[model samples]
Target: MRVLAFLDGTLGDPSQPYVRVDNTGVLRGDGIFETVLVVDGKPRELGPHLDRLAKSAAMLDLPEPDLELWEQAAQQVIDNWEGSSEIAVKLVATRGSEGDPDAEPFGYALGMEIDEKVKRARTEGIGVVTLDRGFGPDVAERAPWLLLGAKTLSYAVNLAALREAGRRGADDVIFTATDGSVLEGPTSTVLVAKGRTLYTPPPTVGILPGTTQRSVFRAAEAAGWTVKMEPVPGGELAMADGVFLASSVRKVTRVHTLDGVALADSTAVHAELCEAYEAQYA
Candidate 1:
């Protein structure tokens, strides 16, 4: 792992602990983050990631992100990382110590090799189980403090959901709203295909906007596949011709089984989208 911690206007080592104990981000999980895939020393979809990071920071009322500094830190980390064909560059910003709410936000960028499990999931479709998120589709609009759309550092619940799925003998989870509307995976966006048309749940459902999903939709559209964003019921997964969990690190990964029921063979669509996804980075 290679990391570049941003201090004032300079970068420091991340392996060394630099965060103070009183930091609000550490104490209360008050922070925002973005993960980008770095290939050939270049962070893919960097602009989109930074834009989303800024939006998340704004939602949290943190200091405006200094994109130039973040970019510099990311480049430094990428340059330092060795032999990792697909490195994950994570940019994070945290609210400073609780005592000083006006203090500058702490920020850092880290680069590390992709996990072997994630790589295997990309090639071998994963089994997913649906878990209820216990929220309604209109929660984000009705309750701003919930921070539904922001990619905050408070991922305890998400992690627990994945663990629950693992306990159920599934590889991942797709969260659903109280009304049984399929929202998204713990760390990915949900995509379903029926013939040549691709469907994804809209952000209006209180899910985070997916940068990778947007890129894949664009590529799919160019390849003569129709793309649409609408509410997907939990039962729809069983009826779709194919289903996938798309993310920056995982790319486009097929979901072989949903709740122990095998989905229609998506080998052809998976191959098509995988090629389209790789071409974007190529």
Candidate 2:
């Protein structure tokens, strides 16, 4: 991953030692983050991403980040990179361990170039498996420290779930509730299309409210289709016309096979959704 790190208004290589001291984000994973897609040199769904980042920070009790400063940092990096049509920018706000130790916050922005092959997964599709149920529906709803809806730096478990899925010959994992209800994928939102209606697990159901999914829904409506959000059963995905994992990097990719069962290749829905988002974002 080619990376550009911003420290105190200066952009430099991430290999440099310019990270501010006493960053709780590195020390204790005490930070909130948002990943956004930049296409044709403009960030997509910027308003919603910032809103969600603010909410996540509030949920974690972190200080408010300077949104304009972060936006300038992103613009600096975006303007410098030439010929790169698309990339993913990660904005993070860390509770700086400076001054009063309980006062203002510090944070940084990181931008990386994502491979075209990865984004092309929208057309090629992916495979998914179910991880061992560690964060179930009931537990996530009741656990006060669960950070169920926050996109924080505590991503060890998310990476682990993806690793376990790969070990099982899958590209990702769809976490299931203890009672067998569907939750979400490791780093993406699950979208299953049944006819013209697109369904996704609701945010109340232990899933991150995805920005890409929001844009896709808007574009879907523009294309004359209805969208539904409710409890999604894991089994229901297999019976749908098509299944997709939506994220900033992956965009929208079909889940062609689930747990070794080959899903019928419904690339047309994939094409429609991809075109919808691309026309709007890319």
Candidate 3:
């Protein structure tokens, strides 16, 4: 039950070829994208995702995204998605035909069912291994052209890290900065809980800001929990009361292990985190 819709209002089956053969997005990976979780029929945190998408476009020196058109297209795809109450929709904007110099920029939205394993991790939790990210926390500010915080279409390194995790018999990864600072997961943001407080690394340290994490923190604050953004050390994750990874599809997922070492069961703590995250939808 996958669906796709173009900005021009064309709706079609995603399996059918649509994008131009020489599209620069496919040839050079020159683009930006966002993954939005659609529950029931509403897209979760659509505004923040679109704002980040625009910020990514600015970082790449591309034209500003047509948010109105994209919103219409994304909603159209969501409306057509069948059989899944929980769907993951991707909105991709790219430089058009590489062979056509005068080609205008174009984009589309595609909707599909979320993977069963990702949903399972929401409850059963995931095991993670820490790997050095090969750069200090200040790299993003020092080297802005590297696009460190942008959600670009290129994710080869992130995908490779997941493969390495599999090789090491781990389910996922929590990347640490070269200076032993906790950065984020390949596809998620890291949050460590300590008693009645929660901490997450600031996005200024070179990670994409997590839309889901922001809402969770707000919900936590409303529930009388202290929330702070700081530079989290890798060791802090191991010693924290609970470690969670936040993402759109997975929401708040508990990190059950680190480097094959079993972490203490923090189910009660994570249950609160889940409730806070889910509060936005309510």
Candidate 4:
């Protein structure tokens, strides 16, 4: 995937050499970001993404982003980018270059790229495993610092977890609490099918509130399927009728296997949810 980035108000050409590096976001990973799906040149679930970004900024005590400026820049990027069928737009606001770790500034970047694999995963569910790494509930509650629920740029652990999951013959990994309750996936939200209801861990349970999951729940309700937000034990995850991961980029992906345990054929409900979601967005 070739990515195009807008640095401040300047557009850097792909053929150009030597892009300036800013230490604020590059060295310390001191920033918050939001990734939205760009379908037909329009962002999907933009409001939710922005809301989450604001929440994260507040958690970090970063300067609040001017939503009006962000919206304008996002629309400008979408207008300039070509082939918008299945594209990802990432909006990032960071503290500009500075030498002090305690200082903050107002600077941001806009990035756009086209990814087809994420779309494919939605149609065909992904294989996942349970990773033994994640912030414990107590630690997260006490000194979150920057890891609890904020989508900060410090994603080294997330990348490591994904690598470990791949080594275990899985496409993704879901983190479990110290007590073995399901938390969430590396970059997605975990949703399971229990009887005729769809269940996902609540935001209070330490998982990012997935915009796609929220939309799926609404669609499920319209389709006559009950949706509930509650805590799910990791052991009982295997007993679910079906398992799926939700994200803005991947949309909704059913999980055919969780830690080598194959879930039942959920193609029917999966299709129903996908269809409803697409229709609603369309």
What is the C-alpha lDDT profile of model 3 across 80-156, one tens digit per residue? 87767998889999988897878898799989888999999989999999998898999999999989889998888
Evaluated at residue 211, the lDDT of candidate 2 is 92
Q: What is the overall TM-score of model 2 with all chains considered together?
A: 0.92
TM-score, per-candidate, Cα-based: 0.97, 0.92, 0.97, 0.90
lDDT to native, each model: 0.89, 0.80, 0.90, 0.77
Instruction: Give stretches of model 1 more than 4 Å off.
Output: 7-11
What is the Å distance of residue 168 in model 2 from its true position? 0.9
Q: Model 4: per-residue lDDT, tens digit, 1-282?
A: 334455444555545643236556777787888888888877898888888888888888788877766766667667667655766778787776657676546444354554566667777788899986555545566766745788887778889999998899888998998878888888889889877899998877667888889999999899889999988888777888878898888888888888887878888878878898889877
Off by over 4 Å in 3: none
What is the C-alpha lDDT profile of model 2 across 20-107, one tens digit per residue?
Answer: 6667776778888888788888888877888898888888988666677778777776777754677688887877764455645766
Please report how far candidate 3 places residue 39 from its true position, in Å. 0.6
- TM value for model 3: 0.97
Locate the minimum summed-lDDT window of 10 residues in model 1. Answer: 1-10
Ranking by lDDT: 3, 1, 2, 4
Which segments of model 4 are wrong by more than 4 Å?
1-10, 14-22, 100-111
As for candidate 3, its clashing pairs are none
Backbone Cα, N, C clashes tallied per candidate = 0, 0, 0, 0
Off by over 4 Å in 2: 1-8, 20-22, 98-104, 138-141
